[model samples]
Target: MHSYSRLHHQSGHAAILFSLFIPVLFGIFTLGTDGARAIQDKARLLEAVEVASLAVAGQGSDNVDLAKQYLEYYFPAATIQDSDIQIKKINCEDNDRCQDNESRFFEYQVTAKISQPTWFPGNEAIIGFGDAYDVASRSVTRKYHSETVDVILVADFSASMYNRWNGGSKRKFLDLKDIIVVIADELDSFNGYMADKSLKNKLGIVGFDYYTSRYNNNTRYFYSHLICGSNEKECTKTNPGGSTNSVNYSATVRDIFNLNSIAHTPWQKREVTNISSFEDVLLTDDMASLKTKINSNSFNITSGSGSGTAFYAGLIRGAQMIYQQGENPRQLIIVLSDGEESNKNTTQKLIQAGLCKTIFDKLNSQQQSNGDNVKARIFAVGFDYNVNNNPQLADCVGAENVFQAQNRDDIKNKILELITEEIGHLAQ
Candidate 1:
């Protein structure tokens, strides 16, 4: 009977020990489950915040609603309050400090907070910890703006540019003129942000044709008509009396170094001072004058002889002018052509002579020295010309930069699209 009593006492001790350790085991299980849930919630919240930040960066100032929408879409089950999401515009002058302000180039910040419930019993009352924990994440994105850009518009005024298209309703030369006017208007629209002295935009024009005039030299051409001097009857016998015409004279390549031969009015000249107000650089009068000059009798070719597209000359001149701007500014050369080069050997020779290689080398050296800044880029637009067939053209610029337009309207749209993509502010 005594031994039975001792066994009962030992059994009571075992029961007490089991009861004491049960709560510890339960707490461990709760921690494992709740810990995993917290980790998963944190990861989900981070991803949602990143996506929301990107969305908000793309949109304008009214980005809070969009951010909240993205958060809800990414985290469907989480009860996210509108107050828990915050969006702010951050303006960073340099890489260091960012503040909330208005600037041409800025950044957007998106922050999200979600309260996740703990699935453990001891989380609420036994410990001083709360029943729910907060999981929050923030993301920042930068926006891009136009850099200081210098563009050289190298246009082809070859004989082929006079060809008629669109059922003879539009000429290729006329379409090219229209495209240039459109591009000028687009550039003028950026006066507000470009008012900064360091961020100005400059453009130069280069019109190329055959071997009529040498580089950096002025050549005069004269067109004559029968002149009646003192004897109208005699002149009429020799020529026509009723038909009165006069001789005309004009100079080609008037100023090659400065490219004044094309068109460089006072308004078209590069601005020296910081623009205090918006000015229409390419005004209606300017466009009319340009059209008149391009369509003048001087530009008309009377002889088919000595007619060829000297594309290499144009490219070299354009590169020289663009490089004169400075090493720091972003340089771009835009070639507008309606036909392929007449002399491929000459073009290849020019390329081998370091026409494009010099610019590429300088750009490479600059990139290596200064952490990947803007380099010289070339874009080509062909009208009624197959850019893909011209491998040399693609090699001169880049294959991806070549564009071909089917019609006049398409040319304008494509050029506008290309320029907008090159210079427009975007989310980075």
Candidate 2:
């Protein structure tokens, strides 16, 4: 009987041990799952703060109210209470202190804290069971501001331009016109807005054909006989215009830098050309003359001997124009081309000159040493050009800025998208 009692006692003791361990195991599993979930939520909250703060930093005063709107759009769960989130230029003064010297860098400082009840009964001990525990996160992001942009559009107005053989030939011409109008409209849209209130970003247009020329009140060769006024409506009108005895010029072949010598396309090679000569290609009242010439077939591609694609020249001139606009502004060149450079110079050289390594290096050196902040982004488009053969050209613009369109239908949409993106960046 005693032996039986001993066995029973041992069994009871084992049962008690097992019972105690069951709860401990349960607690471990519960803690593991809930802890992981809490960690995930914490990470998400931190991300929300980061995204919201970055959005605020990039925005203008008019857009500050909309910053939170973007944050909610990005993170619906993280509710922003009044003054709970703040963004400002990174400076010593942000912590309520100011420096005698100027602040060099700007960052988006985000502060957020969250509180929620514990899920498990025992978790109160780990997460302040009796009261809610606060989970807070802080993050800072640098500001990307486009102080100024020197913009130039190198358009193709070659003889092949008149080729009616292609589908939507007339539409192609209109597309170019629309592109010009769109760019002008975009610039005008940004007209009094600037990152620095004191800075005024300048805008210029350079049209290219066999040649390249800056568009002024006298630019011609495509549509409307009158050089387009600063306003979009004036640009669209077909009349002789504001009628102040103004002279208009058409963009033509010689204005562009021709790579081929007489043996190939007939333009002198290695000859240093002046901007004034590039300027002279514009004919007073050139648009009217261009329309007449286009109708008459006088401006035909076969009419010209030069086949040298002066793309590099256009890029160089465009960069020059940007540089001339004061080193303080950003420099951007939009190069539009349809076909590969036929008998012209090597395409690689042109792509690299202003779009690739050289420009970036130049800007980086200036920015580091002098805070010139003169970086420029190129938007290279190969319209109807064979993608495989010409891939390198657009690639030189950097993956982000390069663009391609299978045909004319995609041109306007793509251009508009790029312009819109840039505007957003500028506003930020």
Candidate 3:
């Protein structure tokens, strides 16, 4: 009878122990489930913050709303209070101090709250833990800007550029000119970093054909216009014909001594001079005047009998202008052409002369450097030209940088897209 009573007492103790331990086990399981959910919410919040920061950084100061939208999409179960979100411009020049008002980067901070109910009864009260958890994340994004910029516009003025497309009303030259004008307008309106008065962007123009001008059978010239002046009026120079007067005087005393009354000798002069090699016509910050010069100079008909495209000559001339700029400036060359090289022999001669190969080699070398900054970039546009079959012209720049257009509207749209992309480039 005593043994039975002892067994009953031990059974009661075992029941009590099981009752006490069951609640502890349930509490541990509920805590683990809630903790996992909280950790997942925090990780998701971090991802959203990073993505939002990158989007805002890529788009500049105008994309704050976009960041909020991204957060809402990524953390649909959590409440993202606007009051808990902070957006601030930060200067990460050295050690991410962020004290300076001049912002070079943007900082995004997000605080998310997620509600998770306890699975075990009285677990939250016993643990003194809240039903909801808060997670905060921060991210910093930087902007990209070059210290200086030098742009060279190389335009092809071959005879074919003046020809109209198959069914288009506008000539290929007009399309090319319109694209150039758009570029000029964008440059003039730019107000970003390195676009200030102390670091104004420089632009140069080159127009290339087989023969720019020929006064006689022995004379052949390459015409270029450099606009480096502050305004249009200062960019003009005396024409070639006005520079000298070649008058043959007879071996008579009357002709040699008659200086006062020379029968009003007329000076055959032009307002511009075309040199044997492409010369700088203007190298200036005056984008307005540069656009005017491009319109006036690039739209002319082929001037000489040998109607061929000197693509290398034009590219070399533009490179020459870019090379003259300050060291490590962001250099870009935009080449527009309607056809490939028409004179292979002349092209080979130029390449041997170091004019064709030198420019491309320099560009390639700059692009291949190990530094973060790309010292040079080349963009080429082909008007009604087969870029796939004839890749040599685009290869001078880079195959990926080439663009082909069929008509005027297509050219304009493509150029606009290029400009927008260039302007919106993210800084490293």
Best by TM-score: 3
Cα RMSD for candidate 3?
Answer: 14.7
Q: Residues 354-374, candidate 1, lDDT per residue (tens digit)?
A: 555565555434442357565
Model 1: residues >4 Å from true position, as ranges?
1-101, 104-144, 166-168, 195-198, 211-306, 326-328, 352-354, 362-374
Task: Estimate every model's Cα lDDT from 0 to 1.
Answer: 0.55, 0.46, 0.54
Q: Candidate 3, which segments miss by more than 4 Å at Cα?
A: 1-147, 166-169, 191-196, 212-281, 302-306, 325-328, 348-357, 361-374, 407-428
Candidate 2 at 114: error in angstroms? 18
Total backbone collisions, model 3: 17
What's model 2's lDDT at 257?
A: 23
RMSD of every candidate to native, in Å, equals: 15.1, 14.1, 14.7
Write model 3 residue lDDT over 187-300, tens digit each, in one string: 554423343346565567677664233223434333321111122111223321111322111111112112233211221223333222222444567888877766674356
| lDDT computed for candidate 1 | 0.55
TM-score of each: 0.47, 0.44, 0.49
